[model samples]
Target chain A: MIATRPLYTPLDRIGWLNTTIRCVLALLGSYANAVLLGSVIAITLSMPAKDATMSAIMLGFVVQLLAVIWVFYARTLIGAFVGLALPATAAAVVLHLLGASL
Target chain B: MKFDKPRSLRKSMTWVHTWTGLPLGWLLFAIFVTGTLSFYRLEITQWMQPETQQASIYDQGQGLSTATKLLEQYASDAEFWSIGFPTARNPLYQLRWRAPEDKSGPENAKGKAKSNAKGNANGHAQGNGKDKPQRGSNNGHNATSADTAAKKTNAEQSQPAESHLAKGADGDKIKPQQGHRGMMQLSLDPATGQVITPRETAGGEFLYRFHFQLYGMHWSIGRTIVAIATFFMFTAIITGVIIHRNIFKDFFSFRPRKGQRSWLDAHAATSVIALPFHLILTFSGLLFLAGQLLPMVAGAAYNGDPRGFLRDYRGFGAEQAAPNPNAAKLVDISAIALDALKRSPAGIDSINIKRPGKADAEISVTTPEGSLFSGKQSLASLQYNGVTGDFIPATSKEHSAAETIWKFMLSAHMGLFTTPVIRALLFLSGVLGSVMIASGLVMWLVARQREREKLGYLPRGHRLVEQLNVAAIAGLLSALGAYFWFNRMLPADMVDRSHWEINGFFAVWGLCLLHAIVRPHLKAWREQLSLATALLITIPLLDPLTGGNFIWQNWLQGQFAIIGFDLTAFALGLGLLYATLQVKHKLAKAEVTKAVPPASR
Candidate 1:
């Protein structure tokens, strides 16, 4: 989405230009991605297993770590899509395989 | 610095408030309106469920007695037996049994597994006497007491705290139990333990579902949406305050006259005056649920130690457990658990026994009472040897002061540990907040119309804004009204009643949008809002027609839940009617003034 009449002002644009905004956004992105991914994993794992407590806790930790990394490095929209999609796809496949084998 | 405000300061504040409010105004408006309606979710549910109308208010004493009997009937050593006392809107006692177990299953799953699967069909207190100890099911010890079980009564004059417990087995010590669970409310006849009113049938449940689509998708996704919406809402409220400079002057400036100016003033007045409340509610809502939404930040920031993180934010500790799968049978639940909980660090109002009939199982009792905003304070779990009947600690360390602070903040924000009177106040305030948002949206539409007339052909910017206004305000109102209709109209015996109810909510909302887009903007707003007004007004009327009455026949019998619904519906109906009249007057005046040319005078 291109800027529709520049929501940011000159001062506001400068504020975004400041290094701190980038860092904050990056951190927030990483955090958000990790939470989103982990939550997805937690929920998906919770589906089949009669006991989801342990899985929810463990998957929550691992996914969060991965999400943080994805947020920091993945800059473009395409990158973000891949960053979110890849882990989710991988997790689903693995979980399905685990369910089948069990 | 002199505190006196200059014109520049006034102008700057106005700019600040406007910018702050504009971006997130739409989302906040949705939140406020939905949330306010959510306050009477139970009442709405009662109005919807006609079958539950007669048996709405369960006898408290009878309910408690039945729950106790059910506890004994299910498992003598059930780790916890929690009961939700009946409220004005939902007069049903909810009872749940928790049993201690090992990581695998209940302690005696192999041999002593009593087939509760059979007793499941013995629903709604059929008086089959099947629970009266059959020849095969009965052990040697039969302490089944049935005296005065049906005649449990409550003195209306007693204190709220005193009312929760029956005269103890000894008629001395008061037993603490779980209070109401708002969103997940299910009405059951305290007399029969049969599902008198399923939560799926309740109106509040739809709001709960809408808030978090507990459907095909995962909870995390819903939580994230709710969180992001809350974040945007906070930002908008803050910006709104900054953008409106002359906020105080417009506090009482509501002109119930016909014009866009009048609309703008009303909207500005409500939002500005209650700005502080709106901000507090949104920020606090996010804060209350931060752990669920922002867990990564919590985990990473606290360095993978869930305990540390909880300690810092929620005053809760990870309950550690040492599994003893081969323990003895559980002790008397009502007596043993309460005794142990009293000994524990935090006070206990609720207890959960996982893996009943197990050797190594946990008995987790929590006292969430008075622990709001403290994150996870008032949680103390005791893992006991189910076989040996020994108490085991869930965690070693207690919550720190900082964690407690976080818990308190959370509790206060959501009014978690508050009394009924305070909760009612909060609920009222929530309604006001919703009205404030609705009025604001209307004001924007009114202002744009004036601008449109001046510019001719309605500027693209104005048209887009106006369309969005119709879609959000009118569309949302119609959807909400439809939810009530669905509740009353849907087949009571429909399979998957809960799922269908939620589907109905979204379906109606979708239809509203479709209708709005096709219809003229002005007509859609008036018709839908007027329909909403009628539906709200008719809700109370439906009660008596559908078996619920506000008269002595119901109220004298302690059927407060149904009566409360009728009164609340009537109140909301009046509010909607007032708003509709205001809008109609404005439209009338605008048209009349336009028709009469100034030169004729």
Candidate 2:
């Protein structure tokens, strides 16, 4: 038996689409995380408002990088989507409850 | 590792990288190149304004006194005055005053009219000096010569009155003076109180603005586009790293002249070598524009009052205060400057006096931050009671931890406070990043061409990408050369000369694109690359002809910044010349091989 390469695999196209979704999710998920994290620190921390704001901004970059890396390392597309969406949603709810504007 | 899986994560990452990078590669190149040049922006501006002689050294107290005297003479009734003392980079005292409401119009017009008359008087004086030989000097003609000289002096003295009358007649036709606005900038000689009129040129400022705002677009739109491109760039760099399994190996491996393999190797090597710089520059670029792009966080926190957040983050309140109406005695500004220098030793960067000659006047002297990495937080400033010239300790506040970190990141991104060696390293990294993107674009075309070659036919899209690669990469260099050439060649007195220089830049770039489209890809590459080579090489040669200081003179004077620019241009020109020659040689060899077919063998 001889091994051969497929000329036009449908799975490759599906994978490309999954990667695109992952990228979009990573971006949105990280943005939401930055906002939620920033507000929580601002409201809960005993530090000055400016200090908390700076900390939140710094964490934003870190979370964004992690989220992007997670998108690639997750086992499946659905798994990655769920992994990102859950935290993003939890953070959003907390922020809303805290009366955060965005 | 082992044999490849059919649906691997690495493959997906590769797909993500390719798709994200290819679309914005050209823009990234432009941004990187211009941003790199901005590191030397001050030097470029210094070279452009060659007529302004560099102030060798000046007593700080003397310079401050000169500034104070000039302000007293020209703007005693003004509400606010700012004095920027001479520095190594800029050798003139930059003074600006905000006029009082009552003094802004009629007083300003009268002042301008008087200055115009004075200028005419000066011109007539020069004319009188030139006609001395024609007045005759023999003993018999002495009386006539004396009479002629007296007549000429009388004419010179009357010239100003005549010009003033003519100016008044045409005053209605003249448009309202823009100088009637609140603030007016006046450049003064540091040693003397006399004003110095420097010629106008955009110089390095255009390149600095071009990096972010681009040209011929609203700044907001341009910044948004740049932010978006920066986001994609950040993504692509991440994906690219994730996909590269042999990252360390790729850093050491480069094979030149192997066609597609060479392109791939060069791209990988350049990317890996400057990977850290790419990551930092992209992330920090996005952060620098975060106020515009990610305003929601600040908005949510402070009810859309971004300025409030910035004020707190910077640890300083606004520089201006409401003016006191009561008249007050003014203290010597030089005393305050000297006192501030005694406290900080680095000398003052600038001094701001609010409500000058008023009871509640405030003076602030700012010194450059000692640490190069503090960004906006590096302003070590002292506030003084304007009337007493006594330091006010309460005005200087310590920054919070958050503000310090934010300032550090911002300053790091701008490369402010960088030593020459660090600046050179950053510049080299930027160049490598540019080359990495250019080679990546070329590799895309090469890969497609190879695939098409297997099928014995090339696609139209592949040809288009090839042409675009040549036009964008090589054509941009040629356009930059044209921009520098135009800076030296444009008429100094032409209206809106700066805009014309920029227009010439775009026009030349547009012509290169047209040439790229019309000619074959190989021929276009060779021609544009050769043109860039010639233009870059001749820039230094034309410096002397264009009234700019020569490279050798700059070298002799220990002006490393100007010499660095000329040497960099000469080296880049040499590199392009080498590339052009290689391309020509390759083409000739290909033609010779074609002429002697394999059938002859």
Candidate 3:
């Protein structure tokens, strides 16, 4: 009987490093996503300014959790980065334009 | 690139869970334990300050009048005055005031210094006679400071003290002072208008603050560290769920006394049993910290003013109109409370007077929300003319759907609105979280130790982890026991008594760490666990020694908080004792196995 070689070594140092990087990306990417989403909601809502801001902030956490999970589960690093960056950029642009109009 | 493979997601997540969870495991454990205790923060505070056992059952109107009279006597010229009404949990009317700017310095400093000396002398007289010399000198210092204060007051009485604010000659704009704000807080007995001077103790507030702010560090730094740890915890929980395939199988599985398998089973059971709570708590904790962690969004939107963002977000209307300089006489506060109660049957939670002394003083009476879980600060409030007591229409606006959901989430996380049973369930969930983290740390060491034994030699890193596991887990429990013991043992009037309690906690924890490093891992665990058990069990005994009513007495008097605390301590002590026995039995079994040869078996 032959013992099969494991795909990843136990306590692999490089594996640890990669996971750390992903963890950091998860935080940053999710934060960006939250901000973008929150801003859009704030702009679209017709409620009082404070309510709009609060609603955006609350919704932001849900978006953040989704973004973080996506970072870990994405097929490729570049794919994950691209996925997060596109929405973040779009939100930023929309928020800036709305602010200018105000 | 390697992690990008489809099959490697589980493996990669397993790796993530291990590293993220292990590194901050100890800190997360401490935070969870302290935070869980904070759920019963008010109860623990009531128990710790035993002197405040007497509850006042005064009528609301009488209580309000009493509070007002005390304020008038002590802080008539205060720039800002606020009163917090008594509740079932705390039967004292809390009054706080910010003195007019000019009176903040020198005089207040002298008063504080004199109070400190007096406190020290009192503590020395009450404490066991171990330091007579220090007590005598403190007494001397107290005498001198008292004399100086008397002389200074006499001199001031001869001539009017300098007024910080210029008297507004009818229709002058009263400019508020900047930079110099002197604040004072006093708790008054609701039954009698006199101040109730309870012995200074940190009580459960220490645990509440320590969970977030951690002691001896800048608040921001502490908050950031806690937030980062919480993020890792969130990550670990997610990764843990992904990596484990047999969630239901693990949930119902428990094979005790099976060594490593038993530990694994315990960990899985704890994590799975309260998985929802863990998720809610971790997510809500992050949301609670959203303002601090992700301030940029709000800062950018509100031009760097977080308060403005919060105000707009919560829909608090315009600030109270400025004080009417020409208006004479302040309206009676009791009238507002009574009038508001008549209009709204929900009862008043608090009353905020914007400009208490001036004619334009607007009194806002906040009505308590019916639900305990409602996140809003106040469900409804009515504003009234400060001088005439005529009701000004309610200014609190309706919250949007988003805001309402946000508030509900925050309140649900806090469990402040919940009944005692629900709070206990939350606390039990927290206890499970602490256990899950502890078992995970031990499981790591057990697995690693097995691997090292197969490889013939254990590395330094493995040994370090072993030591850390013992120290951080059992050692921390012992330190917590010590904190409670110190609360009872320390002199009531001791100077910096709260600081001493905190220091004692750390000192015991540090000693435990040293013990772990010096002793064998198993022996260290057994010893610390035993110490924790002894300390915890003896805690109830100290209550009697410290002049506190016995558990039975408190139980009879319906002071369940103290009784509950004592009983909980005893139960935890028994749990630790059981753990200690298990450790001893395992150690002895290991010795017997070593003595016998495998060939003979």
Candidate with top DockQ is 3
- Considering only N, C-alpha and C atoms within 3 Å, which residue pairs clash in candidate 2? none
Predicted model with the maximum lDDT: 3
**What TM value does model 1 have?**
0.63
Relative to the unseen true structure, what is the C-alpha lDDT of residue B377 in candidate 2, on a scale of 0 to 100? 31
Tell me the lDDT of candidate 2. Answer: 0.62
lDDT (C-alpha) at residue B391 in model 1: 64
TM-score sort, best first: 2, 3, 1
C-alpha lDDT (0 to 100) for residue B583 of candidate 1: 57
For candidate 1, write residues B1-601 as lDDT tens digits. Answer: 1111122433433433343345556656666666665555555555565555556354533554455454444444444334444545456654443333311232112111111111222111111111111111111011011110111112112322433343332233322221111001123464544434232343463463344222345545655666656654554465456456577688867776657777677667766766666766775566434555555433432333333433322112334354345545545555644565467544434444454545644444444333353333333334444345666654554444433433454445445556668767777777777767666666665655545556545555555555666667766776676676766666654555545656676787677777666665565667667877787788666656655574466668876656666677667778768867765764576467763222111
| Best candidate, TM-score | 2
Candidate 2 chain B superposition, TM-score = 0.79
Give the interface RMSD of candidate 2: 4.6
Error of 3 at B494 (Å): 1.8
- The weakest ten consecutive residues by lDDT in model 1 chain B span B140-149
- In the range A1-102, model 1's lDDT, one tens digit per residue, is 222342332323343343243334434654545454444443454332211222343344435434433332333333434566666566556545544211
Would you list the rank order by DockQ, best first?
3, 2, 1
Question: Comparing 1 and 2 by TM-score, which wins?
Answer: 2
Q: Is candidate 1 or candidate 3 better by TM-score?
A: 3
